[model samples]
Target chain A: MGDKTVLYDAHMKLNAKMAPFAGFEMPIQYTSIKEEVIAVRENVGVFDVSHMGEFFAEGPEAIKFIDNMMTNDFMGADLYKAVYSPLCRENGTVIDDFIAYKIGTERVLICVNASNIDKDYSWFESHVTEFDCQLSNHSSNYSLLAIQGPRSEEVLKQIEIYPTGDFPYYSAKEIQAHGEKLIIARTGYTGEDGFELFCSNQFITTLWDKLLNAGVIPCGLAARDVLRLEVGYPLYGHEIHDDVTPLDSALKWTVKFSKNNFIGKEALENYTPKYRLVKLSLDKGIPREGYPILNEEHETIGKVCSGTMSIISGKGIALCHVEKAKFPKDKKLFIQIRKNIVPANYHTKPFITGGHK
Target chain B: MSNVPENLFYTVDHEWIKIDGDIATIGITDFAQKALGDIVFVELPDVGESYSVNDTFGVVESIKSVSDLLIPVAGEVLERNDDLEDTPELCNESPFDNAWMLKIKMTNAEDKSSLLDATKYTAHCEASH
Candidate 1:
């Protein structure tokens, strides 16, 4: 068995169907994916995301070091505003995508995907020696809980320790919840109005029980995929990797060239994207990762990075990479779905939710 | 949650078959639906499609993965659930009532003895878990 999460016993106690993912035994679904998807869309749901990576960086140079590593203009934003940034290679290829929250000049917390934790840590260690920042990987000691959907705010309000905030998307605040400190960020990967709480593992189980008592449903990775696909969020391993740049991942707006010189600035400025990522809605069948895309002339152009049946849209959708010059957002492509070929329409979709956070 | 019909014959692969005279109605069990999670797409076989026992039929696509709905008995397809074309989640909500795949006329109905009953099937799932 791989490393287990702090909530492993809770999952087993609830008879959750465990599946191996990202080198961890995670709950694929507790009740059902459809029910969980509907709950998150219509009501409220909570997820155990302790498998993700979290790090705390502090020092006088933490601001300079952290700001230099990202490609967004977070330094100029409001105090509680969160910024999505792409960590990059020296040659402009994106290493990973993450959210960087600035607590103070000497303190910042970075949340990253689990698969890229080691690689990202090594990347930081290489250049951090010159920045005078103290970086610590606190992934093992912490557990993350995402409370999402239309009723999330109401549920959070019931907890006396949770501070009431009307912060807009990409905003966060440090608060005390249930007699414990938490960093509640109004951010999520599922394109929903939700709060991602970073708290200690010691209290995560108790927090989970409290949420369950509040009638919030427990959702798993199955519904999370559909929600993200409906909003056209690009997953790391599917639509991005070491070779893919943020520019190719359709996140060019997140890159700021005007910022001070950073590790990958030179390569990003000189390089142009070869394939542009596009959102596709499948009419024929369920699109999947690694599924090949056929051009108008039946030529192999790109591959699907992530795909699912959009619960909100009621259609099969996928995020794909296609040749930049030849890519047409309005064009149609034939996706090889099993033994048959089905048609798909392409467009540029935003990553936003319907409910207010 | 243990509601497998005692009269119906079940398969190791989580398929349920009901024998009535010479005809049989086949479908994936409730346990199968719980395991498959949300069923978003269903690929049904044609009415004229014929297959032997263990022959690969069509596919059932969930949000996370796609798996084939294998045929458990040798027979010809009599009908396909047309409702699943637009409402695939019926498999998860009501697997026993509305999620039946097809009705086939069994070639040898007595061969059903190899399958399990409700008591045996429940024990099988409990041990596996």
Candidate 2:
């Protein structure tokens, strides 16, 4: 058995296929991954993302402390805006990728991957020696729900959860619903216009009921994974990990060089990438993790990190890491399935586009 | 509960077989399809391939993972389900009928004795659950 989120009973009632993920027994799918993915793309869907980790960083030096911890430029971030960054080690390898909401200069709410909660907290504690900031792990205190799609705004509007003014993309707002404080952010992993609501665990069931009553379909982690992959968004353990540097994972854009100093900036500046992450569209067969990539002569080149059949494109797609020098030049590659070498072509990522806000 | 036709035979790996003298039609059971969740692709073997019991015949891929299709009886493939090449989801939609993966001429007539009958297979599925 694994840890259960606040929506465990709700998922069971919905007859979801539950599976263990990141030490939590979470819902993998309700109906089907393809159906839930299409619902999120064409209509609207909600995900119980309460298993993710949340942290509160506060103090007079919180802003400076966060800027030093993350790769992105958090110093110039506007209030209520969320900045996506990878927390890296001093050796320039990634610790985890996270989204930090700059609620205020003295206070920031960070969302990190569920599997890295303990490690990330320890890393944060070890690095706060000189800063006058306090960090608290509030992962157990909150339950999160993401309502995503083109019609997400309408569903939230039915419940009167909208703010008074324009709520820009990648921004968060604190509002009151059902006599409880709710932080709704226009952010998601599906590459669709959506809002993520963070509420206290005690009130999450009630909020879930309200969303369901408003005709919102409940999606699961499986659908979210396919949606993110279709958008070419990277998952932590799959696309980037503790052994992978930002340069190797195609995350160089997140690193801000103009900053005086950060955890991985110095090492990143001096180091060259050893591997290149490439996207491939297969002619046939689904490319799965750890599947070997081969050249035209059947020489093993690299391995697939993430892959699935794109429901939109109707083709198998994958993100794989190849040695920088061994990157296929002819755009021709082969993914070695059990007994067959399936041919593929190098393709630009974000297999489907134009769905973001 | 999954559908189990009263006349067909079942294997421990959840494959069903319908025998017509020496010729046998093979397909995965409805229980297997439900467990796999949306079947996106079915890798069928060649029509002329010979296989023994427990040999991996092909693969059935869902969005979650891939499952090996285990051959239940020793036989030489007589015909393959060419329709599944264009629409693998037929396995999920109609596993017993339209998704029949292969028709094989049995090499060992006594292999059917090892398979469970409908009543026994139903009990086996219940016991596993």
Candidate 3:
């Protein structure tokens, strides 16, 4: 058995299939993966992401510490604005990817992957020696619920204190709901207009119950994986890893070379990526992680990192890291599906776009 | 509760076989389908292929993972369920009826004796979970 979240009882009440993920007992599906995924894509769905870690950095040197630790520069970022970035090692290899929110002038809240909570906290502690800041890991003090989909605004409007229409993407605000303090951020892994609510464990349960009673769909990790993959979002262990750098993961846009001396800046400046991440659509068989991607000559060129049968596109889609020079210019590629070699086509990312506002 | 008809023969790997004379129709049990989540693709074995007992005959691809379909008994493939190639969700929607995977002519009719009945299979499923 793994650690159970505050919403464990709620999931059990819904008869959700519980599975161990990132050291937590998480719901893999409530009814079915297909139904849950469609609910997020077409209507609205809610996910329990309380297992994710939260760390707060505050003091006079908070911004300096964050700017030096992450690849994305937050020099002029407004208060309550969330910035997505990759935390890198000295060698430019990603330790983790996270969203850093500027809640105040001297305070920042970092939301990290569940599995990297301890490691990320330790990394921050080690790097804070040069700066005068206090870092606190408040992972256990909070529970997060993500309401995502085309109809997410309509669902959130029922409980949110502020007008849902005014919240911009990558923005966050502290608000009160049902007399409880909650932090609402217009950010999500799924390619949908959504808000992630962060609050105390007690308030989270109440919010979850309220959403459930309002006829909002309760989704699980299975649907979340499919939805993120459909939008070409990179997952931690799959697309980015301890040994994979931002350049290799198609996240070069997040790396601000103009920033004065950040961690991994020197290594990243000299390094060149050998493999490039590309989106693929299979003509027949469904591609899976670790499946060998072959070139036209049947030579192995790369391997799939994430894949799924897209519920919206009605085709097999995959994200693969292929040899930069060997990538087919004609968009033709082949993937080894069991015994047979299936034909595929390479296309630009966000395979199904225009969903997020 | 998973439906396990008393008339069907079961394998430890969660496959069900219904015998019609010397021919046996095989499909995954409702327990197996529910465990695999959503079935997205089914790769069927070619007709006329002969396989020994426990040989891998096909593959079932679900939204979460891929599972190999093993032959429960030694038999020669007589027919494949071509319908599943287009609509694989039938495996999840109706694992026993419309999603029947293969019909095989049994090589050894005596193999049926080793298969479990519905009650024993249900107990096995309960124990594993």
Q: Which one wins on DockQ?
A: 2
Which sequence of candidate numbers ranks them by TM-score, best first? 2, 3, 1
- Stretches off by above 4 angstroms in model 2 are none
Q: What TM-score does candidate 2 get on C-alpha atoms?
A: 0.98
| TM-score of every prediction relative to native | 0.90, 0.98, 0.97
Report how far residue A217 has shifted in candidate 2, in Å.
0.6
TM-score chain B for all models.
Answer: 0.92, 0.97, 0.98
The model with the greater DockQ, 2 or 3, is 2
Candidate 2 lDDT over A1-357, as tens digits, reads 899998999999999999999999999999989989999999999999998999988999998999999989999888888989999999999999999888777988889999999999999989887899999999999999999998999999998887668888899877887688888899999999999998899999998999899989999998998898888888999989989898998888999999999998889999989888888888788999999999998999899999998877788889899888887678678999889999887867577883767
Local distance difference test, candidate 3: 0.90
**Model 1: which residue pairs collide?**
none
Put down candidate 3 lDDT per residue, A295-326, tens digits, no spaces: 88999999999998887787899999898878
In order, the candidates keep a fraction of the true contacts of 1.00, 0.85, 0.92
Query: Which regions of candidate 3 fall more than 4 Å away from where they truly are?
Result: A163-165
Given candidate 2, what's the lDDT at residue B68? 94
Candidate 1's residue-wise lDDT over A161-275, tens digit each? 3556566777777887667888888888776678888889998988889888899999888788878777777778878788888889888888899987766888889888988
Tell me the whole-model lDDT of each prediction, alpha carbons only.
0.81, 0.91, 0.90
Error at A231, model 3, angstroms:
0.3
Task: Estimate, for each residue in B1-129, the C-alpha lDDT of model 3 and write its tens digit.
Answer: 789989999999999999999999999999999889889999998999999998999999888888999998899999999999999999989999999999999999898998999999999999988
Best by TM-score: 2
Task: Return the DockQ of model 1.
Answer: 0.73
